[model samples]
Target: MAGFVAVIVVVDLAVHFYLWKRLVRDVTRPGWRRTAGTVVAAGLAVLVPVTVGATRGGHLWWLAWPGYVWIGLMFYLLVALVPLEVPRLALVLLWRPTSRTSEAAETLSRRQAIARGAAIVAGLTAAGTTGYGMRTALGPPRLQRVQMPLAKLPRSMDGLRLAIVSDIHLGPLARTHHVGRIVDLINSVTADIVCVVGDLVDGSVAELGKFAEPLRGIESRQGAYFVTGNHEYYSGFAPWIDEVASLGVRPLRNERVEIGGLDLAGVNDLGGAQYGDGPDFAKALGDRDPSRPVVLMAHQPVVARQAAPFGVDLQVSGHTHGGQMAPFNLVVKLQQPVVSGFGRVDGVPVFVTNGAGFWGPPLRVGAPPQVTVMDLRSS
Candidate 1:
């Protein structure tokens, strides 16, 4: 853990230093403006680790707002500024001033003009994107409908709606009201089953269990079910297993249940491997009747490759948060086969939702928080 924190601190320093060089030094005159920018840059660099430590370790939940907001802003600033580097570089290489005093002054003036212009563009882009993302993240989750046709599903089970909710990292940013809002939205759907895929909370049940109480309000017919996500392992999976059960949601731990002729199976998150509790497809899917249409609920979409041999008709998952932020999804795809929406992974049809909550920064871009209704169709 120390090593991991050290790496994060190092990376944080590097990012802030580059940001300072571009957004501060290049944009400001050699005076108090530059000094002030240097101070703010350094302070924000320190705030990164402090915010994470205080929130995760010290449990200073209130600091989550300012801390995470700045994180989001910082991220977009880099995203915006990195692209401007190309133009900035081109200007440096193309503009050559001879050893004339007047020419040197003109060249300097033009350079400053371009630098300041680049700063303004990056600043506005980052601010606007972050603002929109904040609104999308903090506001109520959007309702998304996906029509999925299953080859082995019984015709009688067609039109069965499974409400897909995942990545509801219910800690400091997502509280009772947030869960309550999600519950209300899920209830409005009158889904047959509500699947909480994983990454439910960052903290333990003792600290954040009350925030999840709203889940009791879920109005599903067959029932609400939960499968462990990576975060559950971090937040004491043993207690969370019991907590969700107490709230009337069944925890599917490497097990399957027959529901209206459909086999609904769930497994522990892959992260649980560290705790000797990782997903066991054999335990969950080994003896299941092949004729039954199986809908596996594992946290990460990458599990499809492992589950392919099980003859799973469909898998519903949420771990990528649909990338949570734009361009970030591109990174997510490197790990997850299907970041969001329908895809065929190793012959198994998988549907991934954007999930219903935010994680670290309380901001989502390109992809908004969502409660997806997977309308199952028999083909």
Candidate 2:
């Protein structure tokens, strides 16, 4: 953990330094204005780790608001400014001054103009993107009703709806009301089974437990269920496992349960292997009858490959947040086979949800927060 924190601080400091150079130093001459910008950038840089500490510490929840928002803005600013570097470089290298005196003045004026213009563009772009993402993240999750037609789905189970909710990082940013709203929305749909697919909180149960009280109110025909996500492992999986169960939500925990003649199985997150608590496909699926269609709730889409041999008809996941922040999803794709919606891995069908809450920045770009309703139907 210390090593990871060290890396984050180093990378954050480096990025902030780059942002200051491009948006501050390059745009403003050496003056108090530049000094002030430097101070602001430095403060924001330090806030990254501070906010992380506050969230993990679970004490100063209020700080998470500004800290995370700035983080989001900083990300978009970096994105917008990096590409401007290309054009700025082109101008410096290609432009030729005919006379020294006139050339020097013209060059300086042009540089200032370009720098200021680039700064303005990047600032607006970042603010707009971050603002839009914030609205999308804070608002009620987009309820997605999707059909899952399983070839072996029992005729009695036809038209069964399973509401999939994952990654509700209910800590500093998202509190009780957030969970309440989601519960209200899911209840309205009246799903056959509501699957709270892990990543329920960022802090420990003693800190964020009460915030999740709204979960007990969830209304479903069968019952609400829970499974561990990668975040759960990070937030002390054992206690969270017990806490989730207290909310009247059953934790699948590498186990299987029969519902509507369909086998519903779940495993610990694949990432848990580092803690010697990885997914046990055999325990969760091996004992199952092959003839019955099984729907697996494993937090990550990549696990589909591991569970493929067990014959998972459908795997629901939410780890990627559908690349919550745009080009970021492209990176997510490298790790998880499917970022969002239906995708096949090792010929196993996987449906990755964008999840119902934000993780770090309280903002989402191309991937809007969602609660996908898997409307199971017989193929």
Candidate 3:
């Protein structure tokens, strides 16, 4: 835990330093403007850690909004810095031939002005994008429908509508209202089965129990089932599992349930084993009817690799949030095989949802939040 915290701190410091060097220092400005810029940059640098600490301590709920907003800004700044710097570097390289000419001073000043202008444009773009993302994040989750055809699926279970909601991340940012809205949305879908694929809450059960109460209102024919996500372990796994159960959502800990003529199983998040008990695919599928089509719910999309060997007909997952934001999806791809949507892994169909809620920054770009309804069909 200490190491994790240290890494975050170091990264935060590095990002802030780079922003200062490129956006504040390199830009030519008056003495007062420079001083103001330095102060603002320094304050933003400190705000991230301070807000995180205070919010985790659970005292000032108000700080969470601004803190997370700052976090969003920081992320955009980091992304923007790369593109912004490239142009400046190119300008320098292009001007080398005329370095000793009388036009050098003019060229240097022109280059600085252009760099400063680019910085301002980048900042505005980030702000506009973040603002739009924030609105989308706070909006009701969009519904995504997918059809999965299984060769051995039971005729009786054909057209079985399964609703998947993942990564709600309920905490200081996502409140009871958000969960209530989510419940209403799920209920409206009239799904045959509903699955909560982990990262449901960011804080402990004791801290966020009240906020999660609305989940009890979720209605489904086969009832709501849940599995651990990486965030669950961080937020006190046992208590969350029990609390979710109390809300009438079954917590499937490496367990399978035969429902509606279909074999449904759920395993702990990939990170579960690190916290003590992990996913046991063999045990979960043991004694199952192989003739029946099986749907496995694991949080991370990468878990499909394990499901393939087990002959899972379909694997439902959501951990990538489809990159949650632009370009970040490119980064997410480096980690997970699929960011969102349907794909085939070793002949098994896998559907990864963009998730129902935001993780950090309360903003999402490129990837819109969703409550996916996957209709299973027999081929």
In model 3, how many backbone clashes occur? 0
For candidate 2, lDDT tens digit of each residue in 1-379?
8999789989998999999888888788889999999999999998998897876736788898999999999999989999988998898778777788799877877787788889999999999999999999999998998988899988888999999999988888889999999998899898999888878888888888888899889899898888898888777889888888888899998999998688889999877899999999999999778889988999888889899998889999888898999979989888888999999999999998899998989999999989988889897
Alpha carbon lDDT of residue 60, candidate 3? 69
lDDT by candidate, in order shown = 0.90, 0.89, 0.86
Q: Write the per-residue lDDT of candidate 3 for residues 1-379, one digit (tens) a residue.
A: 8999899889888888888877887785659877888898888888888888777624466888998998987788777768767777777667643445757676767677767887888788889888999999999999988888888887877898999999988988888988998889899989989999999988887789999999998899988999999988888899989999999999999999988678889999878788887999898877777887788999998887877778898888998988988879999988888888988877767889999898768899989999998888887
Regions of candidate 1 where Cα sits further than 4 Å from its true position = 96-99
TM-score, predicted candidate 2 vs. hidden true structure = 0.96
Candidates 2 and 3 compared: the better one by lDDT is 2
Location of the lowest summed lDDT over 10 successive residues in candidate 2: 52-61
- The C-alpha stretches of model 3 lying farther than 4 A from their native spots are 57-59, 92-108
- The TM-scores, one per candidate, come to 0.96, 0.96, 0.93
**Candidate 1 accuracy as TM-score:** 0.96
Clashing pairs in 1: none
Clashes found in each candidate (C-alpha, N, C closer than 3 A): 0, 0, 0
